[model samples]
Target: MRRITLTEVGDRAGVSRSTASLVLRGSSKISKETARRVREAMDELGYVYDRSAANLRHARSMTLGLVMNDLRNPFLADLAVVFERSVRRAGYTVFIGYSGDDLGDQQQMLSAMVEHRIDGCLLMPAAGTERESLKVLGSHEIPSVLFARHLGGAEPYIGPDNVEAGRLLGRHLRTIGVKEAVFLGGPSPSSARAERLAGLREGFDGRVELVDGGLTDSTVSSDSGSKAVSRLLGDGTIPDCIVAYNDIIAVGVTYELRLRGFEPGSDVAVASFDDIWIASQQVPPLTSVSTHAEEVGLACAEELLAQIDEPRQNGQKLIAPSLQVRASTGSWRPRKEDR
Candidate 1:
């Protein structure tokens, strides 16, 4: 059987299709008798309204896209919560997309968001997203705000000052008498990771010997941290400290050291970035640089809303970092010359 059409409903209601449409939309201008007749016809004919079709005519979906690289990271989980709350209060619903740090996936998800005609987007770009991939959004004139990492454009973005955060971590490890340190997990396409490494290089400048442990799996996971430790152990090189890319990696390195009969914090200090919730709950709490994920999320959301309101306005905002000292880095212990 053919699907019941709006024209049929109008015919049964003894009215024009436009009047029936206005009645179905609950327009206050519709007379009580005509509105009742249209609704009765719809019920009798079992007419199912297609909201998507109606939305296209009006031209606003009241929806926004929120795309992030890794949802497994606790920092991003927290960020999503904060960002969702702020956008919802402004009467806009969010369509979340996770790209798993893959460029193809990022492009596909962003394309879907554009096709859905979302008002705007908040993107935490994947590792290898290029200008070509983002052009899909540009072609549609869909505004986007980058979070955590950017793919290079004039669109507004909000994130932590990663270079300074890395420097902060480096100086903390150095102040604790670390003479040799291994910087684990990187060379990712993400600007955030690069900035972190650069900051660490600056912090340890002329003070400590820093070796790159290299990527174990991906730039942002504990598996990479464990792999870095394996490489170091196989090479018969163990530094006084290991600076992980994030708290997850720091936790992995801390346990890996324990399995090797090295007491973390005393024999081999471990530090990382992003003071996630688990950073302080480990056997020996992790020392880390706090990027304030929640604040960044809130700021990013606000920036996107501002852009949605005024498409021409675009800028970048950076949140400063803070150090969270814990047992993992031996911050409470008195520094003694061991060299």
Candidate 2:
């Protein structure tokens, strides 16, 4: 048997299709008797209301897309919570997608969000996702705010000042008389990573030497940190300090160091970025740079909502960084010869 049609139910109810539709939508304008008649007809015809189909007629879906590269990182997890809460309070639901730092997956998620007719999006683009690849959203006229990893261009972006975050770590390490250090984790060829490296270079500025232990993996993760430390141990060239791309990687770095008979703060020093909630909960606690994920997420959501309202391409937000000192990194005295 074919599916029951709303028009047939209207005919059975002795009412016009529009009036029946109003009754089905629970419009106060419809009389109780008319609504009851429509309901009876619907029950008789076994018709089911398709709310999504009804929503397609509206000017807005009251929905937003939230796409991220990774969820394992607590920073992103916290960001998602903040963004979702803010949007929800404004009467919007969120469609969450994780691309796992893959361009293909990101594209698929964007396409689906477009198909669903979401009003806007907040994206942390996957690694290697060029600006052109995200043109799908623009072509569909879906306003978006890029958070964390940006793909560049004049589109709206809300993220941390990575260079400043790096500077915070670098300056602290230098002040503590660190002579040699290693920067670990983070995906390569990334704007955020590059900025941090530049800031570190400036902060060190001939005061501290660095061991070139950049990305051992394509993306930032605890596994990458563990592998980088493992290789460094095999080389028997331990730096005075290790700076992680984020707290997730710091967990691995600190754990591996201790497992290999080296203390985190006493034997060597460890510092990281993204002052996640767990950063201060670690065994030694974590010395980190605060990206303020909550504020960033809220800003990004507000920016997108504004874009959806007025459609601006130049919207941008850059959050400042602050340092969180912890036992993981200890201040050392400068040696007489070095001083």
Candidate 3:
């Protein structure tokens, strides 16, 4: 039979895992009636509270768990490989798990990692993850470090400094005399995109007007980029520059521009984030921000390992990003011909 998870108990009791945990520990914070509900739920589920076994869970397991939503993402794919080397050199093994960015899958992954008693966990949380969802880790006193995305609460997080990336692009645009820009972004309600835009505004210093491309829900790809740019052009909302969410999106934007007979480099400067492998291979080559994928992996491994040694972890480390300027954003000039 499978072990009864705290998440299941919490679900049955209509309380959070933290609340259920407090009931197990006899914490005074829980009301008598609430505690009764949790206790009864535990009894119904046949939970075994082996305190000694729980303590031994924190002992060296010589293994770590890594969870991510997507392995296809180049940066994350690179991170997986680099992070393994970083930890393996430190005399540890890593177990990689994919959550498909789904909340249910994430819950299961975390539970499995806990059951295995991995020494620590490195997480790139699924989209729409709440701090409450991470209560499972807390309930087990597991050392977990988040990367690439932040989920509020006091968890250690590591990711590229997106705001600085935006600043780099913005400053570059200013040098080229760009008075207006349309930012093509993916995935709505994203902290990274918001931070980048805020930095861009600061970099522009009120000199350049910013337009929202309004295509955040679609997957980041050449096709989405082409569609976003096509819609912008159809609305007669041409700008001096196009800022894409990533290299793939930028490629699409450039393709759509060429289809409309507008030269990407000469007529409209383009830039993107994530100086991926293909960024330099583009027709005019892309201008992008290098998040330094290997460095991010190393930094993330450092944090999770430290947290495993001591559970009280410092929160949030932002790795600096650098801009790689190329032909794409070099020589944009207003077209002489009218539409």
Q: Which candidate model has the greater lDDT, 2 or 3?
A: 2
Question: Which candidate has the highest lDDT of all?
Answer: 2
lDDT string for model 1 (191-219, tens) is: 88888988998998879888877787765
Off by over 4 Å in 3: 1-55, 334-339
TM-score of 2: 0.80
Q: How big is the positional error of residue 270 in model 1, measured in Å on the Cα after superposition?
A: 0.4
Question: Can you rank all candidates by lDDT, best first?
Answer: 2, 3, 1
lDDT of 2 at 54: 65
Cα lDDT for residue 138, candidate 2: 68
Q: Please give the lDDT score at residue 243 for candidate 3.
A: 93
| Candidate 3: worst-modelled 10 consecutive residues by lDDT | 330-339
As for lDDT, the candidate ahead, 1 or 2, is 2
> What are the clash counts of all predictions, listed in order?
0, 0, 1
